[model samples]
Structures are given as structure tokens and as C-alpha cells.
Target chain A: TQTVSQSDAHVTVFEGDSVELRCNYSYGGSIYLSWYIQHHGRGLQFLLKYYSGNPVVQGVNGFEAEFSKSDSSFHLRKASVHWSDSAVYFCAVRRNNYAQGLTFGLGTRVSVFP
Target chain B: GGIITQTPKFLIGQEGQKLTLKCQQNFNHDTMYWYRQDSGKGLRLIYYSITENDLQKGDLSEGYDASREKKSSFSLTVTSAQKNEMAVFLCASSTGLGVYEQYFGPGTRLTVL
Candidate 1:
């Protein structure tokens, strides 16, 4: 079985400040990692994904995440955040083999203040 | 690009009532999934289908039933609504099951009175 963990339940940051949300996963074999953002009551929108390649993957709105194999982690980062970035972010993982659904973390709620 | 649509943005049901939520995808994807999202928690998969008439149970499939009558449509039913039960049901699809990004619908907010 696979599991995802987002340690931070809620994070508050000032506008224009850099932010990082931590994500950790445990899987036996090859896996895929992805991030999604949900604003208020809306559905989640895909941000970026990491399978294999450069450890650093860029996503929408100046957001990027780094995959660390040794750490078993994929942490999302942004050089500068805006007020619109306030939302709940989710980290998900899936195995590469079959048609199984993704296992998601509890999620990290980001609140950007002006 | 294609889109996923879920009907009845909000659902209100009584205790012991059976409610159904519908989803349709124009992406023509081969796989579809239903997930339940509680307040302040991540999504839990309820059921999934790889093709028409094929159903697979997920981690949270005990109190729910699912149907995939056609390729483009998938529906989920809550067996018996519990009092004061409130959660969001999300529907999503992918081009294929493995290693593909999922496209999510707006979701259906279910409230039991």
C-alpha cells in the first residue's frame, strides 16, 4: 500500500513572501507525484506532476516542486506568492503499474495575507 | 481540451434516503473515478471504472454504490444517508488509468438533514 503525508495542516504567509509546502510519501516501487490546488468551494486544478527526470518540476503560477528520492519527498515551492494563492493544496501519489486511484495527503491550507 | 460535468451542484437529503450523483465526461477517457471529500480532509476513492460496465471498489466503497452504464457516464449512489452527514463528492477522469493526470468536475455538495 502507498501513503502520502503532508505535515503542515495550515500555513499562513504574507503576500510576496516565498512559501514551501512539504510532502512525503512511502511506496514500495515506482511512483508518480502530483500537486493540486483547490480554491474555496471549487474543485481541484492540477498544478504539476513528477514521474522521472529533473528533480525540479515547474508548475502554474510560478509554483514549482522538487522531488527528493533520498528523502522520499516532493515539496512544493514558490519564489513569491500572491493573495490569490490562498487555497488548499493537496499532494497525491500513484503507482506506475496498474489502474489504481491516487492516494492523497490530508492537504495543506495556505492563507495569504496582504 | 475536454471537460467533466457533474449534475446537481448541491444535494439535500433526509436520513435513510438514497441519493444519486451523476457525472459525464467529454474527454472520452477510458477511466473514471468517484471520490468523497470530507471537511478539511483529502479525497477518498469510492469507486472506479476502467470501461463501460466495469466497476472496481475503492477504499471507501462500503456505504456507496456505483454504475458505469456507458463510457462517458458514471454515477454514484449513497446507500443510506446519515443524519447531519455533509461532504463533497467529486468525479474525475483520466486518459488512462496509470500515470495520467486526472480532470475533476466541480463536485456535488451533499447535505443530509
Candidate 2:
């Protein structure tokens, strides 16, 4: 069994503020982790992924995540979020014994205030 | 230059009716998947195919049937539409490496009346 958990359901932050959205997973064996962003009325777009080497991975739009094997976590962070960054962010785990379908966390809705 | 296309951007079906959604990926990727997203709920994988003519059940495979007749396309059919069931069906394709990011389609919105 595999599970992905996002502790925050909704997050509000002012523009230009640093933010961190938490994600935790439970899975045995090697895993691929990814973050996706969905704007209103749009499908999810891939943000970043981590498989091996360099626990800190960089993604599009200045977003980055650090994979902590010890904590079983991969939390997405941004130095300064833009208003356009307001959207739903989902964390997912990919493991093929379950046939490699992404197991997603209930997304965190981020709101950016001017 | 790759794209994943999902048909019937929005669908309204009656309870107990069979609804089918289609997906096509131009990437020629060997793996495709279908997922269901309910309001305020996490996405649940419904079905997936590793290659042409190969189908696999996902965590939420019940109440759904899937077909992968060709490598570039996969379709999913709702066994019987549930009442008031509203969800977004997402299709995705990966490079078959078993460890890669998935590219997604825009999604088909299904509404059961």
C-alpha cells in the first residue's frame, strides 16, 4: 500500500513571501516523487521530480523541493511566490508494483494576495 | 512537442447510463493512465495500461472498465454512472521507464444527473 499526505488544505500568503507546502509519503522500495500545479479550470502541470542524487531538486518557476528519506517527506518551497502561483498543488508518488499510477495527495489550495 | 488530448471536455450523463471517455497521447509513450478526481478529494487512479493491449486495475478500478487498443490511446467506460457523481477524469502518459514524470491531458468533466 502507498499513500501521499499533504498536511495543509489551504494556504494564503502575500505576494513575494516565501512559502513551503509539506508532503509526506509512505512506500517501500525505490520511488519517484513529483509535484504538480493546477491553475483554475486547468489540468495539472508537472512541477518537479526526484528519483536519486541531490536531495534538493529544482523545478519550473523557481519552485524547489527537498527529498528527505529520513522524514519520508518531499516538501515544495518557493523563495518568492507570484500572484500567478495561486493554484492547487498536488504531491504524488510513483511506484510500479502498484503498476505505476500516481498516488496523489488531496491538493493544497494556495491563495496569493497582492 | 507532445500532447495528451482528452475528448468530451464536459459530459452530462444520466444515472445508470454508461459513459465513456477517450484519451490520445501524441507522445507515443508506452504507458497511459486514467484517474478520477472528485471535489475536494485526492485523485484516485482508475485504470492504467503499460502497453498496447495490456490493462491493469488501479486503486479505484471498480465501477470502471478500460481499453487500450492502441499504444497512443486509452479509453475508460463508467460501468454505471452514479447519481450526482461529478468528477474530472484525467489521462496521462509516461515514457515507460517506470520512473518518470507523467504528462497529463486537460481532463474531462463528468456530471451524473
Candidate 3:
């Protein structure tokens, strides 16, 4: 079974500061790792995904993630954060099969202060 | 661009009452899913349909029933509502061929008293 883990439950950062959210996974076979962001009282929006190729992948709103096979991790990063960047971020994993549903982590709530 | 619409933004039901949530998507995707999100917890898949008239159970499908009568719609039914149970049900869809990105709806908030 594929599972995701986000160690930090909450994080605080100042506007214009860089932020990084860590994500790790445990799966025996090939899988897809992705990140999503959910604003207050809203549904989740896709951020980025990694399957193969380069370890680094860029996402919307100046966000990017690096996939590390050796570390079994996919961490999301942003060079600079805005107050509007405050949201709950989730790390999810799914098997290679397209029909399978995603297994998600508990999520990390990021609070960006101006 | 397509949109996913979920009916009854807020729902309140009594103990042991059966409740149903509806979802409609115009993405023309072949796969749709239903998931439950509790406060401070990650989402758990309840059901998914790969195509019209197709159904699959997820890890948390014991108390839920789902239907996909048409390609554009999928519905979930709560067999029995438990008192003090509250959650948000999210509906999502994908292209079903090989795409990994799934579009989600605003979700339906359920509160059982």
C-alpha cells in the first residue's frame, strides 16, 4: 500500500521569506507523488506532481518541488511567500495505475504573515 | 475550462437518517471519485467510477453507496447518519486515460445532529 507522511502539522513564515514543506512516502512499487493546496473552506487545487525524469518540478504560483529517490522524499519549496500563500498543503501518492485513488497525508498548515 | 458542481453546499441530517450528496462535472472525463474529509485529517476515498455504470470501493466504503448513472454525474448516499458526525465530501474527476491531475468541486459540508 502507498502512504504519505507530512511531519510538520503547522508552519509559520513571514512574507518575502522562503518556505519549504517536506513530504515522504512509503510504497513498494512505482507511484506518483503530488502536492495540493487548499485555502480556508475551499477544495484542494493541484500544485505539482512527480513521476520520472528530473527531480525538480515547477508548479503554479511560484511553487516548486524536488523529488529525491534516495531520500524517498518530495519536498515543496517557494523562493518567496506572500500572505495569500497561507493555506493547508497536502502530500498525496497514488499507484502507477490511473484508475486508483490517491492516498493523502495529514497535511501541513502554512501561515504567512505580512 | 470545465466545472464540477456539487449540490447542497450545506446539509444537516438527523441520527440514522439517510442522506445523499450529488456531484456533476462537465469536464467530460471518464473517471469520477468521492472522498470524505474530516477536520485535521487527510481525505479518504469512499467510491470511484471509471465510467458510466462502473463502481469501485475504496478503503472507507462500508457505510457509503455510490451511483454513476450518467457520464457527467456521480452521487453518493450515506447509509445512516451518525449523531455529531461532521465532514466535507469532495467530488473530483480525471481524464481516466493516463492523466494524474484531478479537478475537484467546492465540496458539500455535512452535519449530523
Candidate 4:
């Protein structure tokens, strides 16, 4: 069984401030990690993913995440956040086997104040 | 551009009622999945299908049934609604069995009264 852990359940930041949402996964063989964002009344959207090489991956809306093998973490970051960025962000891990499907974290709700 | 459509934006079902939710995708993806999102909880996979007529159960597949009638369509049925059970059912699809990238539908909000 695989699991995903997100350190923060909620985060609040002012506009133009940089923020990072931390995510860590329990190791269990070859793993594929991805981040998704869900706006109120909307569906989940793929933000980015990391498979191999280049620890850092860029996503839409100037969002980025770095996969750290040593720390077992894939943290989402943005240099500047806007009010529109207020939403719930989820970190998901897919194990080498499909029996687990996608293990998701409880999600980090981000509130950007202007 | 392709979009995933889930029918019945909102559903009100009585306890022990059998309800079905429908999902259709124009992406022609080969994989479809159903996930349940409860308040304050992350999405949980209920069922998945790699191809037409193929069914795969996920971690939380105890009381749910799913069907893949065609390559681009998948449906999930709740065997018996539970009282005070409220969750958002999401349908997603990917190009293949790989879980790298997936597109999600708007979701169906179920309210069991």
C-alpha cells in the first residue's frame, strides 16, 4: 500500500508573496508523482508530474514543484500568488502496481488574500 | 480539445435508493476512473476501467458498481445510498492505463437524505 502526506492542511498568504505546499510520499518501488488543483465547483486539473530526471517541473499559472528523492517530498511552489490561486491543491502518488490506484493526500487548501 | 461531461450536476436520493451517475468523454481515452470526494477528504478511487468491458476495483470499491459500455463512456452506480452520506463523485480519463496525466469532469454532487 502507498500513501501520500501533505504537511499543511490549510495555508493563507498575501498577494505577491511566495508560497510552498509540502507533500511527501511513502516509498514503495517505482513511483509516479503528480499535483492537482481543484477550484470550487470545478474538477481537478493536472498541475504537473515528475517521473525521472530534472527534479523540478513547471506547471500552468507559473506554478512549480520540485521532487526531492532524499526528502521523499514533492513540494509545490509559486514565486507570486494571486487571489485567483485560492483553491485546494492535492498531491497524488501512483504506485508501480495499480492495485492502489492513486493515493492522494488530504489536500492543502490555499487562501490568497489580496 | 476534449472535455469530460458528467450528467446530473446534483442528485438527491433517498436512503437505500439505487442511483447511477454517467460520464462521457470526447477525448477517446482508453482509461476511465471514478473517484469519491468527501468533505475534508481527498479523492478516493472507487472503480476504474482500462478498456471497454474491463473493470478494475480500487481501494474503496466495496459498495460501488461500475460499467464501461464503450471506450469513451463510463458509469458508476451506488448500490444503496446511505443516510446523511454526501460526497462528490468525479469521473476522469487518461490516454492510456498510465496515470501520468488525467482530465476530470465537473463532478456529481450526491446528497443522501
Q: Which lDDT values do the candidates have, in the order given?
A: 0.93, 0.92, 0.91, 0.91
**The best candidate in terms of DockQ:** 1
Q: Give the range where candidate 2 chain A is weakest over 10 consecutive residues by summed lDDT.
A: A94-103
> In lDDT terms, how accurate is model 4?
0.91
The candidates' interface RMSDs, in order, read 1.2, 1.7, 1.7, 2.0
Residue A86 CA displacement from its true place in model 4, Å: 0.5
Q: For candidate 3, list the clashing residue pairs, or say none.
A: none
Clashing pairs in 2: none
User: Which ranges in model 4 have alpha carbons more than 4 Å from their true place?
Assistant: A99-101
- lDDT per residue as tens, model 2, B1-113: 89999999999999999999999999989989999988888788899899999998988899999999999999999989999999999998988755678899999999999
Give per-model CA RMSD. Answer: 1.1, 1.2, 1.1, 1.2
Clashes of 2: 0
Displacement of residue B55 (Cα, Å) in model 3 is 0.9
| Off by more than 4 A, model 3 | B97-99
Candidate 3 lDDT over B1-108, as tens digits, reads 999999989999999999999999999999999999998878988999999999999879999999999999999999999999999999999887343788899999
TM-score of chain B, candidate 3? 0.97
lDDT of 4 at A105: 94
TM-score of chain B of each: 0.98, 0.97, 0.97, 0.97
- The deviation in Å at residue B11 for candidate 1 is 0.4
* Stretch of 10 with least lDDT, candidate 1 chain B: B94-103
CA shift of A65, model 2, Å: 0.5
DockQ of each: 0.75, 0.66, 0.65, 0.64
Candidate 3: docking tier: medium
